[model samples]
Target chain A: MKTEAFVFDAYGTLYDVQSVSKITCEKFPRHGELITQVWRLKQLEYTWLRSLMNSYRSFWDITEESLIYTLDAVGVESDAATRAQIMDKYLHLDPHPDCHSALDALAGVPLAILSNGNQGILDTLVENTGLDRKLEATISVDKVGIFKPHAAAYELVEERLNVKPENVVFVSSNAFDACAAKNFGFRVAWIERVTRKAMNREVDEAEHVGPSTMFKLLRMQMEDLGMEPDYRLTSLNELVALR
Target chain B: MKTEAFVFDAYGTLYDVQSVSKITCEKFPRHGELITQVWRLKQLEYTWLRSLMNSYRSFWDITEESLIYTLDAVGVESDAATRAQIMDKYLHLDPHPDCHSALDALAGVPLAILSNGNQGILDTLVENTGLDRKLEATISVDKVGIFKPHAAAYELVEERLNVKPENVVFVSSNAFDACAAKNFGFRVAWIERVTRKAMNREVDEAEHVGPSTMFKLLRMQMEDLGMEPDYRLTSLNELVALR
Candidate 1:
């Protein structure tokens, strides 16, 4: 496969979204993990819901809104200070362990992040993680006023990068993103961070699974939406082999 | 409000979707509640997702697919016969206790169902529940090839019923549906079946909430999507007063 550019989904593919749990737990005590799980899920849902409604809000706004909803849903009273403190974590999300190495291995390729994140957040996040040095561009759905899984959102990659869909390897840990990218004609590599065996075992063994495990069960697995990714990888480190 | 028509959302509004839990419990033992919750969530998600992806599958297909995914996620093995037996429950979903009385109260008003369900399933469900006598039309997204929250889906009501959006009082128990219908210019009545106080109490009192309660926590509340329903009522019977 002659992959011309590697376009990654930032939040889950290259950045560790679960890293927010550290801060959430610190602030909310017992409710941290649940807030983290619900916050992320609601964040994604808002994007889809807004997209379907043709109501375009910036990803930054959506993130804050979803956070507020999550706090209320989990019975935590959130003030301006608390909300601001938690929201700041998005700008400093820890890069996945393999993120730097994988980018370095494909150093010569035109690497960029095509994320549901707003450009300001994406830029800050990449720079904070020292990934700005390797990444050529940090694309945001803000440019198009819609979120991922929408065809126009995927089209932003080709529009900005000057690459055809077939030549770009769109990588995402989100099953819906990978499916949509593939459906939009990109050569997709779905980073399967959660394995099927692990998922089944978690469900079988745990009488009451925690928020993180439940998140994996609901969101991490591949969707049955007819579009399958060209490659199913366990980690971003595996992307080097494809390069 | 000179109400020209009353268009109801079928699932969770007129029909009690949770009633499927009875059969799911019978079929999957302890996993039934989880299956029911996950199944409903996934089913709504698939609609939004497929709509955004521009890949329109009939609601029936999406329902079955979500059920299969739910069974797998919950660590239950499902075969074709098992799937069929469980799916059959959709055709005969129990009407909410208030459904008939509410419809009956608005005697002379033109009544219909505007649903994401496909025509075949909607017809059978309405007929099986004896709602067909009161309903002049069972409007499915099948006619428009898209699901709710999309303006196009709501536009079908005006197209078929010859009723303008402002004159039609769109009633739904689904918050998202109510918001979308209101956003599309209808006089939307959101049936608040799960009260905010009840939801908060459920979260505060329970150590680990059940699937049904979790569904209420996650889905039953009004969205922060800017489009609020014109009226918020605790029961369908309250809708009669608005008429």
Candidate 2:
């Protein structure tokens, strides 16, 4: 299949969201991993909740709010300076190791990011990771005032790139985003970073699974939503062969 | 304040959803607690997801799908019969210990249930728990083709009870439901079953927090969604004094 533009979901697809755990660990010591997992989950939850309630907030605002909730819920106390330091990590999340190599492989292919992140942070994040040099545009859900898996958020890709959904290979590591993109008629590539078999083996072997394992068991697996992605790739490197 | 009707959320408010853990433990052995927590969380996620996607499915369908997903993710194998047996528990979830007394306390006042459950299941579950005698109506989001946290779902209360939002006391132990109900203009009474102070104490006291504790941390607290419930009560019994 010939793809027009490789439109990607920025957070999990291109960048390493778990990279935030580094700063979290430094600041809160043992609670880093827990906070990281809960923060991301709540951040996504806030988007869906707001979208359903017809109350739209910027992804940045949602990120901070979810962080506060996570810290409070995790029983960690943090002042403004510490919180700001933690929040600042979003604008500089490390890109996945395979990101640059995969982008380089698809050199001539038109590339852009469609993210739930606001435009300012999306632009800053891409630039910080040196990914901006490789991409054409960084699209944010802020344009549509709703987060994906909403159809309107997906429409931003077509409006910005002048490419139809069928022509664009929308790639996301997030199961919900991938399913929603496909449901919106995009040729979706879901990055299956963690396989079900691997997860099952871990659960079977480990006597006691931690919060991170539980998070994976709950959120990382593919959703049972009727829509499924067109392609299930193990990593961004696989995107090159598809194109 | 004069309340026109007292509308309660079915799953976590009037009923104890964790009661299903008894059956899940019987079926899955050691993995029952994990499955029960994951299943409930995913069940609620599916409703919000479907609502946001404009892909409305009955709560019963969502419940089954989430269970299937949870079993697979947890690496436990189950046949249709076992699955059906487990699903059967929803219809007979134990009402909270305080449920009947709270209903009895407000005998002269109008009482109803506005739930994400479908009409048939809602009716069946209420009757099974013997809450049918006390509840004047069991309102379902199925009628609205969307789940709670959506404005349309809350409108069903007014349509069915003919009570204005201001005069209605929407009681929910589910934080999202309570917040959304309040956002929808009801005088929401959030049953603070698991307080943040208690959650923090648990986190501080425990060396390793379990999935149930994490579930409470992630979900049981009031959301920072810019809408706060009108009243915060420790138990459903406290709901009596409000009237």
DockQ of 2: 0.80
lDDT tens digits by residue: candidate 2, B1-243: 689899999898889999999999999998998899999989999998888788989999999999999999999989999999999999999999999999999998999999999999999999998988998999998987998888999999999999899999999999988898888899989999999899889888877767888789878998888888999999999887778
TM-score of chain B of each: 0.98, 0.98
TM-score of each: 0.98, 0.99
Flag regions of model 1 displaced more than 4 Å: none
Report how far residue A109 has shifted in candidate 1, in Å. 1.3
Q: Model 2, range A1-243, lDDT digits (tens) per residue?
A: 579899988888899899999999999997888899889889999999999988999999999999999998888989999999999999999899999999999989899999999999989899988998899989999988999888899999899999988999999999988888888899999999889998898888877767888888887899998798999999899898777
lDDT on C-alpha atoms for all candidate structures: 0.89, 0.91
Query: Which stretches of model 2 miss by more than 4 angstroms?
Result: none
Can you give the DockQ of every candidate in the order shown? 0.63, 0.80
lDDT by residue (tens digit), candidate 1, A107-191: 9999999998888888888888899999999999898898888999999988999999999999999999999999999999999
Worst lDDT 10-window in candidate 2 chain B? B205-214
The sequence of per-residue lDDT tens digits that candidate 1 reaches over residues B1-243 is 699999999999999999999999999887787788889988999999999999999999999988988887777888899899899999999999999999999979999999999999999999998998998888988988999989999999999999999999999999889988988899999999987777777777878755666678678977777788999999999988878
